[model samples]
Target: MKAPGNVIGFPRRSFGRASAGRSEPADATDEMSDRLLAVAEHGDRAAFAVLFRHFGPRVRAYLLRAGGDAGRVDDLLQETFAAVWRKAGQYDSRRATAAAWIFAIARNRSIDAFRRERRPEFDRQDPAFQPDPQPDGEETLATRERAESVRAALAALSEEQREVLRLSFYDGESYAAIAIRLGIPVGTVKSRARLAFRRLRAVLGGRREELR
Candidate 1:
């Protein structure tokens, strides 16, 4: 959904400018986090207005730098913040800083734009589209067991640790990219990833011993 003009209460033309050169202060970040929590818990329009004003131009600049068309960047920016508003309850400060969570949403919006632009028409009759051969009973059972073990190990992790693992391995994002997306230092990203891996190894290793 587009950000309502009245809701943002800012000059639309200003969105073309980049905010990256400016460094956000620690106190400002803490205040933003508190405002976000306020919006999540109370549906406070004033708090939301604060977020929209702060993030609107920044997200617009980010989308443009990420190769988004200037024409569509405004729409993407609106959608990104709209998602933040709708999904505020899902935000966990323990998992990521406010900026990181917001930028991650912006990154997804940019990726979605690219996917839409390059999407190919599906061919139902193509030989390459054939389904894979069904696995034999033993193979299927083995696969199921392995998947269950991995799921269990993952479940043992804290939410923040699982997010690092997902972004690093499942999403194939680089540590630097994850740092940018999550609004943390690269060192912090690496620490979380290292800790996550150590925990996974301990959990999975214990399961292997049990199976043996």
Candidate 2:
């Protein structure tokens, strides 16, 4: 039997890339998208297996880059694809490519995990403040699902755009600090962040309104 949390085995063969170290042609992503859509439409375990092999490591790497615990990454990995299994049918290829869609799932899962472990700060000055109400399971999940659309917006960003945003928001770096670390000027860091935020708002703003 497969491991308890895993839906498929790790594939020994590398996918999409050729043996000569050349990147696969453009259709490779589209092919993966079609396969994922197949799993969505027909519940194909074999197709899910292929996707797990291709994206599993990349998702884990994303969580790691966002400061997830090494020990928990495997569990997070399991949770992410489990969600993919349940929610794959909702994926819209026209709105987001398969890889981008999967990454959005991973991002939302990470956010959910963070929320579960986070403790809110307390301040004595506000008498009107009350503790956050605990959400029922269905409500909690609904919120996480909504975050997927926002993450899809993030997936549209260029790597440079995403990297700066990750450094600034995920790692909580100041603009100057990010510039220093990336060996770029502070103006460039700010520019990248501005462009990323603009794109995110442009893409996610309407989606957020729809959820409302």
- TM-scores for every predicted model: 0.45, 0.54
- The prediction achieving the highest TM-score against the true structure is 2
lDDT on C-alpha atoms for all candidate structures: 0.68, 0.71
Pairs of colliding residues, candidate 1? 100-182
Candidate 1: C-alpha lDDT: 0.68
Tens digits of lDDT, candidate 1, 4-120:
543444332223222321353322454566667767876656668878888788888777777767889888988898899888987766445567678778877777785555534
lDDT string, candidate 2, 1-212, tens digits: 44434345322232433233335343345556666776787676777888888899888888887667998888999999998988888776655677878987787777777655663444434797774444345433232234455667888899999999988766556799898999999999999999999888776554444354
Task: List candidate 2 segments past 4 Å from native.
Answer: 1-27, 115-189, 196-212
Model 2 TM-score (2 dp): 0.54
Candidate 2 whole-model C-alpha lDDT, 0 to 1:
0.71
